[model samples]
Target: MLRRNVRLRREYLYRKSLEGKERLLYEKKRKIRQALEEGKPIPTELRNEEKALRSEIDLEDDQTAVPKSSIDDEYANASERDPKILLSTSRNPSSRLTQFVKELKFVFPNAQRINRGGQVISEIVEACRSHEFTDIVMVHEHRGEPDGLIVCHLPFGPTAYFGLHNVVTRHDIKDKKAVGTMSEAYPHLILHNFSTKLGERTSNILKYLFPVPKPDSKRIITFANQSDYISFRHHVYEKPGGPKSIELKEVGPRFELRLYQIKLGTLDQTEVQNEWVIRPYMNTTKKQKILGA
Candidate 1:
């Protein structure tokens, strides 16, 4: 049954990918048709310009380079005395992610670290239920991807100040679930592929990179595509307000939400995919003496 389920999921993903591709091509053709109908002449100069842009895009897609960081300076720059920043990561920490920790420690000085799979989900949920964390500040790398992970989710109201992360899951979660008073939704953050500052740098550095645009307005498009006569519909909303009655403008199909910010609009696809920012939301005048600060 498990094998069958996996096969079914693979099939569904394959079909979804093909449908998305077809819809993209159709949209491109539709835009071109609209331009022609608007009495816009397809100038030879414009054609040349488009060709040049396409060439650049193609070149970016072709180039693959691993980003470089000064690993030797990581430990030297950061002593053990920094306040810790917590974010989730796969159980097996990647070299790039460790390097990020090193750099974050160097910059912050009192850097504490939390792995994503340290605590059980139930325990973490219980902690939130109590007054453990009132304010949660998430500082994440803005990767231009559809499914960016979140570093923090604070309880509603104040006094819940426990930084409980390294939370684990036995299965992949894509839907929303009720976790105490708030719903622990999956994919807390989503950003667009071309909407990141790093995306601009990436596009500039790699000639063939095709960056997706950040939606001019914030709205979710329901009923945008139909495949095999099956229609999929859902509402995407603005965050911090939680699931309230909020209306936003519709964007392109590639857009996905990540935590509070739309994915590509906030995060960039760097070598380190799981790096995140975390801090307690507090207004204390008395400076907490951090371990290494």
Candidate 2:
């Protein structure tokens, strides 16, 4: 009887230990799933434990839940139907940005202004998603020019923050109708990646918001490369086969977008912008090797 009692107590203790282990694992998975759904970057400690959990658990994963990494990766897509743009700024309204946001409204009729309200990019991203905003165009101001523009697509993104150069408007241009027609064409695009492979990838991104002119028409857009500061050829070009000529009249909306943060192909600019800023003092020298942009 004494031996039997001892054996029974040992088994009870072992069973309790097993239950505790299972409970801890359940919490880990719950945390991982929550973090992934919120688009939080998983902590390295949690990531390591996740590897360990994979080996410890042999049962098939819960059918309703996906791997944490897969859920995190889903943010790379722009899942919305229409491009509902939200214009935002980080600092308090610097008059210039305020004015641009206002003009941007007339230019992009549906584009609406959202106050920063001391919230960080992560919160802004979540807010945009909750409000069903499809894209975000954030203006970064310095001196007089709205020198930086960040574009983020929601619910999963290809976010781009560009260093703007030579911004122009209809009032500033000689041919106002030429610029007006570009907008009227509805989804006209001029994207240059400086090289072919990069251009194709970048074009897909701009296409999500500004889809190609449906069936093609005569609206003009001008995009230049990283090295080319001399001239921007503005015209409508013939398709690859036919005449292979361009109607080069040399007039269009004047603007230049040089890529500053290429990570927009995958990550959220709202989230990443927290760690970056435009350093006018740094200029083009050390600025070439960016820590974060």
Each prediction's TM-score against the native? 0.20, 0.50
- The C-alpha stretches of model 2 lying farther than 4 A from their native spots are 1-80, 106-110, 117-119, 175-185, 192-196, 216-222, 226-253, 264-293
What is candidate 1's CA lDDT for residue 49?
A: 54
Model 2 over residues 153-216: C-alpha lDDT tens digits? 6554556667767766444567554443333444344654434444544455455554335666
TM-score of 2: 0.50
Tell me the TM-score of model 1. Answer: 0.20
- Name the 10 consecutive residues with the lowest summed lDDT in model 1: 223-232
Q: After superposition, how far is residue 59 of candidate 1 from its true place, in Å?
A: 65
Residue 252's C-alpha lDDT in candidate 1? 16
